[model samples]
Target: MSFIESLTLMLALMYIASLSYWSGKKWGAVVTLLLSIGAVAISLYWPLALALLIALPLCLIANKFAPEEFKTEIKINTLREGCQQLLALSLFLVAIQYCINAIQLKQGSTPWLMRPDVVDAFLPIAGGIELKAIVTLNLWDQTHPAAALMLAAVLLTGLLCKRAFCGWACPLGLAGEYLYALRKRFIKAELAPPAWLDWPLRMLKYLLLLALFYIVIGMPSESIPYYLQGNYHKIADLKMALFFVTPGLITLACFALILALAAWRRQGFCRYLCPYGAILGLLSFASPLKIRRNTQHCLIEAKGMKCDKCTRACPANIIVHTKTTVRSDECQACMRCVAACPKSAALGLSLKSGHRVSHKGLLVLLLLALFALPLTAYLAGFWHSQTPDNIRMELIQVIDRVGH
Candidate 1:
């Protein structure tokens, strides 16, 4: 985007943030503010950065002086949706920038636009390998350090916030949501697999995760440097982009299956295929935050009613009402159940001590934990790729021929 366009987006975000704060959706305001800051910082527009820095203090002041009514709790579902939309847009822009850089390199010219290093977030396999290298050999990946940083950030998020990343930030999850909505339009009832089938299907992701770990962990430590510095690894992101852009018949068929399964069951891809999500789901077991049920406040226990709204509202098909504490890996921490409950106190995301973490506070912590890596990495001069532009230009030309 041009300077004028970026400035307009920043100002628009700030305006929406102000409106969100005034309307008592404080998390929405905070998201917009953070997005604006990220936009300026990534683009390295110091003037706009100064503007955001100034506006941030003012926003904090406004929030502090706001009336009690304006501090009302944000609906977690709404906050998740807003976050999904913003992140979708951000990723879209990154894709555009990445393609533009590739095009520039293909034309044998230096890219005028700075490459968006965040694109490395897609290279989880590379990141995993690099992480092993870091642990075993004290070697940092020069080609895609951002990948490792992103991996750390996501792992930290999983450790602290469950699978909120999948619920709120993953683009694939956002796409699956629309597919789910479309499914609901045609099928009035939920279509879930029986336990016999569901259990095996869910194991697919874990098995895939194990296969990935086997390859990464089983590699001789000596070969780590060779793999990281290989030409194929240097253009792995471009190779990934091409996989979607120029998918073969098998790739298309796999996509068809994914869409059909997602329509048939909620979060089917995350549940059955995403190795990254499998890692997060496992780590989330150690997270202090979980959805806790209060029998004293619940309609099922307190009023002897046959209410199962929380269970019905769950996209993950978790029986939220049956469990005093939701410990299932399938739980995305989306808080759909909490929002669906008739009694406000019946369901909540709480620590072990029963101290409820407010939705706003959760958003703040999740975002901070997730972004902390990129911010710190950037400050430490480790976020961007160290690959020279001339080498990248040459590599893009033979990207098709380069292979593992």
Candidate 2:
């Protein structure tokens, strides 16, 4: 996007976010849906006839779920009930964008992947938190800055609202969640990742985090972007082609294999493998906005109803089910538990206006250090930018190994 277009989007989002924050109207959600629609419309790749599907979000506006969070609660109106569905609908429009690209690729209408013009940041890739941060720090200049800021805003919202963006803002995550709804019927039960496996999986992201750092800090910084730029082609394009033709098809095969694992373990990939999620989990810690627990009205003193639904619905397997108060980094703020609790167990989301960050500066510094460490590594020659020709191949192999 150009400077003016970028400014317009930022102002629009800020106006909408603040409007929702202050007025407590449903307009915030509406604006969010509109922006997603606007994003789709901006592409203009979709058929004009498809605009008729405005009914998708229209239906969502009618089905909003009540909040019902506490004893005297601020329940969402009808619009909240179908927020997820509307979000999914908006994202489905984005999938249309992706499908257009795929179609263009097949028809020889365009050379997309390696084509700097069509490839780079033009594709529909969102919900990757690390990618967001990297772009924020200007690590990926090729990325659309407006989109990056929009993503950052969404991430900040998630920090404040507990993964609200995962369910509401992220186009890609919406696709996954929608697919999971269908996949769930065929599966048995959801299990938290086991300690041994889960522990190892957590390291994968942390390691990938460090690897990104090493490439940035330890490698020659000038060389790093070339590596990233080239690898963008390899992963997004070369890999797509090789998926059908290569002997090293295990990587392509892993996509389905991971989904199968998710069937057994709900959000297994999200829980343990997503580097973007790991960063958010870290940054969100110091987020002044936190979920407030209504300790006085909790379940231990009450009857039949307790905190069963929130934790049960938690993809992160947050242990809200057993606790009077729970504030783990793993919480996604999906609001399943908030909406699911029978007694309205006093669990409420809090909009923190201010807090004591000075006392927590050490931890805040740690998060910053964690972020800068990767960039330093790129400039310093610790990453895999040693050879430009093979950097793309190497990064994929690295990402595949670590992402799995």
Candidate 3:
């Protein structure tokens, strides 16, 4: 099948699965399962099918042995941490494989496996900006299908769950969480910038978004800034891979700085500097699903007192107890506030229609659909680069010469 054809089929299946699940009917699970099987069959991707098969039984077993409701919070947190670690490890392995491929290429040997452009796929801002260039500058043939698909996945997630991807799926956020945990364990305390300082810094990402839009849409293609240019973007991607493959002083220093900032203030980069996250945050304001506070049941209100546990628990520092519905752009739907609330039913995730959402199950399904579609296309030989091998080789040579 052609790449676009495969992608279309995958998207159709995803839409069906998502719709079924969103219906919140008893049979939604069955329909989603069938659609998943159909997706595997359509793509002829046995590996994905096999993984799902294995996972289904394990999930069943886990559900059967699941802890009581009150005890489940700890289990859920553990599961989230485990998933984050697994994702981080998977990225590390991919980096190692890419390095091996590069080494083989340098030694004049044909690498058996080519590295997929997964990093670029995660870059939704870059994809959106490139799409603008395509539409405004008539760069029709330069469509990056993988990146486009990834951006669509992210936006779809935002529509459904309100920045759930940032909370549950972002590797960088997971890393920041880990760093914060470590800092708390070692230092016993962490500091946040004063609200006056933080408020201004938080505006930086929006300004950056405006600047990037100008670069992608206002500037002529030939006059685009150096780092934002195509070849240079590829070089940056290469450098990212090299950070894992062959870490240098710069990479280590940058990593340390990020960790330090994350330790100082949870999700510091995401809160202040991530243009992609800023875009998602804006879209998430329109999401129907959000954390709702039962003010009447809240312990603080009940006692005619003030308790800031939920606020303290929030990584985004949102005043969760004050709002009946958390519609803040900064809310990532992490549910930390919900878990931290001492009063039962004081906090929960719900749709605007008042239907409560099952956080873990729905989030897991969304993430599964997001990754499975692209992976199925990849397995169908329809998701890799359309660029000629000779051109790619030439670009690699140039990157190596520039010592990026």
Candidate 4:
């Protein structure tokens, strides 16, 4: 099969599976299994199969050994967080290795995984800008298929589960959340910025987004033709990768600043500085699913005090107890609020139709599906850049020379 054909089939299967699962159909598992088999058949890849094999038993074990409702939320959230951390750390190490391998590769050989570029590929802003440049400059030969695939995956996640990517997939977010947790446990206090300060700070990302769009799209037509021919953007991507792989003093300082801020306030970067997250937050409003509050069941009013457990647990710091439906663009759908609610069913993820989504297993299944589809396409030799090896080698050489 052609690469586009294989990619289309994989995505179609994923959509079917997601729809089935979200609609509470019993055939969700059947469709998922079919997807697994189809992926292996198309890619001739064993990793997807092996991953599914391992995950199946783990999911079963989690369901079988499930704790009481009160404990279930924490345990599941912890497990999810651990998985995010492990994946992030593993990917970081792999990126470092990719850089080393790039330096050592023979002139004609391409790296198998292209790990250094994966994060860039997944960044919608970067991809969207590149795509626009390609179209505007009529540079069909300079296509970035990997970036396109990543954008598709991200958009799919947004449509299906809102900002689940921020809570469950982003490595930077994992680190931020861990820092926030440490602050909560060790410092035993919340340190939120005042609303007057916080509200304006949140506008920074939107401004950054606008600035980037202007730079990419508002360039003079005469200069754009020349700009596209130059390797400016590719070099910028390499610089970003190099910053993470071998942190200079400035990069280290910036990393420290982010950690310190996260320790002071939960998801500080996500709230204020992530341009990519800003886009997702806006797109999340189109989502049909949301965290709904069952105020009638709430115990806080009975006790003549605010039971702000749900509010306190929200990583986005949204006031969950007051709203019948959480429509905040900042909501990550992390389910911490649902778990933190002492009263059973006080907070639940529900569709607009009022159908409550209560199963932890389904969330796990959705996460697995999100990860599995792109991997299958990648293994099938569909989701990668078509950049010439000579050009890639030259770019690496430039990065190595300038990075030092």
Candidate 5:
């Protein structure tokens, strides 16, 4: 394994170990510690090996000194946020690695750094087209197969676990969390729109989803192969990076608008603008797992008490108390409702068959669904790009002149 890969793995293991220690799970800590040791042993790099040795004891010391309340509350939110941060950091590192390779390729030199295949996740439009080609022509994407595979992985996550990907793994969702936090701090309110306007705004993403599909699905199957092999599609990731790197006035305006909206109303961009989230939301309807209300255990139903903690805690504003099963498309399966319920058994994520999934179980399932396809593809030698470096070098030279 490369140094970056080994370092990322070591850091991820150590992060899990620290979280487990802080969350008071002895077994988790021990197992992760062993894994961290394995990572260090295989790393072979002295600096990382030394850092791991130091980090483990420091984590132990930090855990020992943490307050009792701190330990208790570091359960659900901590696990979810930890996963988000880890995934986001991984993407950021992959972006950096990608930039290094792109820069080298542009300079007419073979890339010294390994180009990360996962960066293809940025090319969802291409993925969508490639997926269509796969379905229609049985042709796998040779150019950026990882893109289609990653899209499939995400769809599987949505199909199996609702919008758990959005809640537990999305980097944008993490950013949205911070934006909403800022809103709470500065604006002192959610500033939610009235239902009359909110309902239509919520439909925006679905409309965007429709528009995206209209383009992808309408393409002639014969055209897909040509399009996928085209110069524009080949270097789509570079173009994507450039958009962010050299944002025009309209791009900046759109970003500012999205940020402002996210701050004004929780997950504003996700709730209304993210076509990916919209697709997931629709696919999530098929998921057997959902946040279900237990009437027998609910305080309002069982004890004649007024309680709406679950509803209030929900970021998506689903009326958790009223629904026997939260069937709203907006529900992200975030478990904030479950976490906030005063009655321990009042609200829980359960299958239609009444089997409950523990928080940890959900996390595991989400991770599996999110990575299984890409991992399988990687193992099968289909994850790496088949495009030649010579071709890539030529494309990067005239990337500014190439367009769809």
Candidate 6:
């Protein structure tokens, strides 16, 4: 691994540990912010790692340009959230594009993978040198080399942006959000994450991580990619195919169950069953962005709009009314409170000021993310190297009907 990458892993690990110790220490968040900036800088910025020189101010602008009331330091009138929602109407667009391409004159299924088609459009990055290739991950085929870096990228982004990936980038999150909208329309249950169930349930996602590892480690190392390479792919070796095709409807069912939980208790999936949410929730402890309060200016003093609205509107169920300080790392930086605050003084993400975060914990997360950098990369490459027998060179001759 490159020294900088090693340094990054170290920093990410330290960030994780510090979160465990202090949970939401401001210093830890600061450290994470710096490290995250540095990682991106070194990896993508080249010789200077000067991305921070640019990024920090942008984040400040994100905070300052947040909304007028938040910037005013005086009144509260037009605080209608500016954080853009990352909802995907792309599914419909892609579906439309597919219909246009259909050779079929008439078919019930449209044979084009109509409306919410499973196809993914290529996303060029690094000046189009790299791309987000289309992908699928069902029960049989699992690990996606094209996706691991994407996952890691999201994981790393959590440090500064809070849950921006979930709030802004993840298509699955959009799906979940849409389901949630449908849920509110059909049912009204204020499900609470009961203390007994809440903490235990969050462990499920990691268990899922463990399950993924177990499935991967058990498969023939050579055929891993074929299993993960997505649908109708030739990788359908008997054992791997059986395992790959395994994720089942239970996956959707799981979301349905989580949605049901959220309907009853707010953010039930995030608070409980989502592994990514679990990691984000844990790492979020070090997020530089957060919801803050000024107890002195708080509504509890006058009992009007000061703190009531921010706390009430917080979908995460964080008690913003009570938290005068940016103490909880679990905040998503969703800016919901920033928008909802009738008294803008009640919430904002601070860069310099906050309770002290643990510098020691920062050290730990740095070490870990650094270590995982190459390890995860190697694993990614390793998984990809294991080609499936179904993908045999000889088979191409049989299918394409041209001489090999």
- By TM-score, who's the top model here? 1
Q: Relative to the true structure, how large is the alpha-carbon lDDT of every model?
A: 0.81, 0.45, 0.65, 0.65, 0.81, 0.45
**What is residue 32's positional error in candidate 3, in angstroms?**
2.7
Alpha-carbon error at 43 in model 4, in Å?
2.1
Candidate 5: tens digits of C-alpha lDDT, residues 30-140: 886775566456535564576676666656676788776655555677778888898898888887888899899989999988678778887888899999998899988
* Candidate 6, residue 324: lDDT: 60
In model 3, which range of ten residues has the least summed lDDT? 1-10
Indicate the worst ten consecutive residues by lDDT in candidate 1: 1-10
For model 6, how does the per-residue alpha-carbon lDDT over 187-303 read when each residue is reduced to its tens digit? 766556576875567677768656554554555544544434533333222123233235568766765676676555555565556656656666667776555666655667756
Candidate 1's C-alpha runs over 4 A off are 1-71
Error of 4 at 221 (Å): 8.4
Comparison by TM-score, 3 against 4, better one: 3
Deviation (Å) of 44 in candidate 5: 16
Off by over 4 Å in 6: 1-87, 91-145, 210-259, 262-264, 301-306, 326-329, 354-404
User: Per-residue lDDT tens digits of candidate 4, residues 30-118?
Assistant: 76757667667766745445554555555446445656442344454765576577557656665565565465543446655443435
Arranged by TM-score with the best first, the candidates are 1, 5, 3, 4, 2, 6
Model 5, TM vs. native: 0.85
Clashing pairs in 3: none
Q: Whole-model lDDT for model 2 versus the true structure?
A: 0.45
lDDT of 1 by residue, 1-404 (tens): 23322333344455457656766677988887776777666758664576666666665675678665544654677777887887788778777878888889889999987677778889888998999999999999989998998898999989998998888779899988889889999887978889999999999999999999898888889999999999999889889988988899999999899999888888889999999889999999999999999999999899999999999999888998888999999888888898899999999999989999766566666676666566556656687798888988898898889998
